[model samples]
Target: MSTRRFFAVALVVSLLVAGVASYYASSHPDGLEYVAEQTGFIDSAEDSATADSPLADYQTSGVDDARISGGLAGVIGVVVMLVLSTGLFWLVRRRGTDDVDSDDARPEHARQSEA
Candidate 1:
């Protein structure tokens, strides 16, 4: 499939999974957190540096409604991921050929020598 089509599908799927499916995610702690609690070390865990950030804890801070907060956080996360991934890919693709001579710019002598 074309690159545009592929990216469009990817964005849609990402938004759907993050925004909609996240609402149904289990509220209970997962394996690591559960184990920590079971082992009696859960209280020792330090809060993340981002703990005070608006989007911390998978939900938007200060939002009165839980559903809206989580959904907004999910969509924001997806958009950020897409932007970062695309930027990294673009940087990688542009790195190697920036100063290389194009076919039309090669000297006739150089071209003949390579031939």
Candidate 2:
């Protein structure tokens, strides 16, 4: 299949799985929190800068619904990571690619095209 079709199928499949998993997820604290509680460290846990973050605790502030909050947090984390990685790559690339037309470091085809 073409790139578009492939990506579409992947997205649909991923969404379907996510929906099913979300529907079946337990409302209890996740593995880490459970471990912390069992180990007697949960009470000592305090908020980090992450605590104030929009996606903190795998939930948004004021969200009463568990599944929605977790899903929203996951989505937000994905978006934030995508944006951050793209931004970092662009910044690094911009410095190198900005003057390809005028840069002597470029290859013959680029120099010829620019000329």
Candidate 3:
């Protein structure tokens, strides 16, 4: 498939998974939190540095409705991830192009001398 089509599908899937499926997820702790509780150290865990952020606990703060808050948080998270990944990929692509251009600009003798 074309890159644009692939990315479009990926974005849609990501949004659906995060915004819709996330609402059905179990509220009970599953991984590390569960382990900590079972081991009797759950209380010792420190709050995340971002604990006070509006979207801290998988839900938007002060949103009133639980479903809406969680869904909005999920959508916002997906958008932020997409933007960051796109920027990182763009930078890497540009860096690769620069490397190729610089290599091409060097004379054959200069290229050989660097080896």
Every model's TM-score: 0.81, 0.54, 0.85
Residues 1-115 of candidate 2: C-alpha lDDT, one tens digit per residue: 8998996786666555553465476779889999999999999997797678776766767778877777666666555665798799999888768775458777889779967
Span of ten consecutive residues with least summed lDDT in model 3: 29-38
TM-score of 2: 0.54
- CA RMSD, predictions in order: 2.4, 5.3, 2.3
RMSD of 1: 2.4
**Regions of model 3 farther than 4 Å from truth:** 108-115
Provide backbone clash counts, one per model: 0, 0, 0
Model 2: pairs clashing at backbone N, Cα or C within 3 Å? none
Local distance difference test values of all predictions, in order: 0.89, 0.72, 0.95
Model 2 segments more than 4 A misplaced = 1-42, 99-115
Full ranking by lDDT: 3, 1, 2
Off by over 4 Å in 1: 99-115
TM-score for predicted model 3 compared with the true structure: 0.85
